[model samples]
Target: MRAPVAMKKVVISLFAILAGTSFALAADTGCDAFKWPVEREQALFPSAPAAQSGAALTVGEAVDFSLAAVDTISFEVPPGHAPAAGTFGATARVTVPPEGELQFSLSDDAWIDVVQDGKTVKSAAFSGVKNCPGIRKSLRFKLAGGAAIIQLSGAKKADLKVAVLTPE
Candidate 1:
């Protein structure tokens, strides 16, 4: 009976040590262990003709904006015109200058897709970063001077910073 009790104690001790070690390893690896709650606020979409509209952005300019979890912004095409989807996350239109080139970058924890003429031209996934805890990505494209749309989406509770740079 004494020998059996001693063996049981040893087994329990080993189990505890193993569990602790596993937890430490997971922490060190920066595992995505927590989920953030999504906000219930409605997304804002400015009118196409508004001064704040993406279509108002001129060539050789850069626009920076922040997006909340599950939020999206659409740019209207053909400078100063509204998108068919209304003022919602569906689409944003911007007139790319003739032979113009644009560069786009996003902070960690967000996804971006660019659509032109109903086709997806550029897409990138969000990656994890040690310092920022989000993804960093960039894409460049040449335009033929017409309407183009930029769509942005992000994870729950995660906010993202996006920058759009146009050629000078």
Candidate 2:
């Protein structure tokens, strides 16, 4: 059996090992700004769009916002997960503006796969991502004149929640 301190040490060691040289640094602005992108709140395609399932964050270029820092981002998935069924993923473009390197990170148990300028840049698997418990995930992107759709995926769509976009 491992003591609480030992368990924490193991987790921290794992995080430090994977995070490389910046595991202790927090986003300059905040942490509660990774909700839906600044776009129209609608389901994808004509097909239900998987609500209570996942959200498509449509981010526009030339737009920047601030966030309130948090501790973690929790993610929860269905009982059994499979690939062929596509474990709830999302899609988004970088929008028209052509800028710099867009950074993205995740909180809780959720994960994000980014498609920049019509190409896949990064993908991550966050653990224990649940309904808006905590969100410290951060990702930045360089504008490229178009739109970016950030599709989210996991076990249960309703189980995950990041900082939702301020209602417009």
Candidate 3:
């Protein structure tokens, strides 16, 4: 068991090195898409009083992901000051192009999930990124015409970007 785990890590690490892997919306999209809006929006954390809400974002809205952990990554709260379970959450919406794939890097010690039509498609564990502090790890998901919902749980106020790629 331990051997397999170690081997898997090596395989993933190599894959990252090889596939060093968004934006905008269509006229049919419900919301307006911007050029990866970083300046337009603000960061939310698990604390700060104001950042203490689990708002299920409306699809097609211009928003970024906020994790619930120590403020070590992009949009983060302080360490030891991490929020309790369910205090932090996030969502990223992506339009599936017939058949497409989504991939992104995230922190390792984070609880991330991918949901489609309320039904969870996949889930996994990530160990912080190599050489990248705070940022978890990388994840890849393949989907069809259905909607893609990337949810970030656990980390109480961190920053994570989303991208939909490899449309076919």
Provide TM-scores for the models: 0.42, 0.34, 0.41
Write one digit per residue (lDDT tens) for candidate 2, span 1-168: 757998999999998877864534333123223343422211211221223322333332111111111112222322122222423333233333344334443333434544454454443322221332234344444434455545455523323333322122
What lDDT would candidate 2 get against the real structure?
0.36
Superior by TM-score: candidate 1 or candidate 2:
1
Ranking by TM-score: 1, 3, 2
Residue 156 accuracy (lDDT) in model 1: 30
Q: Tens digits of per-residue lDDT for model 1 on 19-88?
A: 9999986775432321211111001111112232243444433343433323245333222222233122
Q: Model 2 clash tally? A: 47
Is candidate 1 or 2 superior in lDDT? 1
Per-residue error for 129 in candidate 2, Å, reads: 12
Ranking by lDDT: 1, 3, 2
Lowest-sum lDDT 10-residue window in model 3: 39-48
| lDDT of candidate 1 at residue 152, scale 0 to 100 | 53
State the displacement of the C-alpha of residue 108, model 3, in Å, after optimal TM-score superposition: 6.9
Q: Which candidate has the top score in TM-score? A: 1
lDDT digits (tens) for residues 34-72 of candidate 3: 212221122211111221224333322333354544222
Off by over 4 Å in 3: 1-87, 107-109, 123-130, 161-168
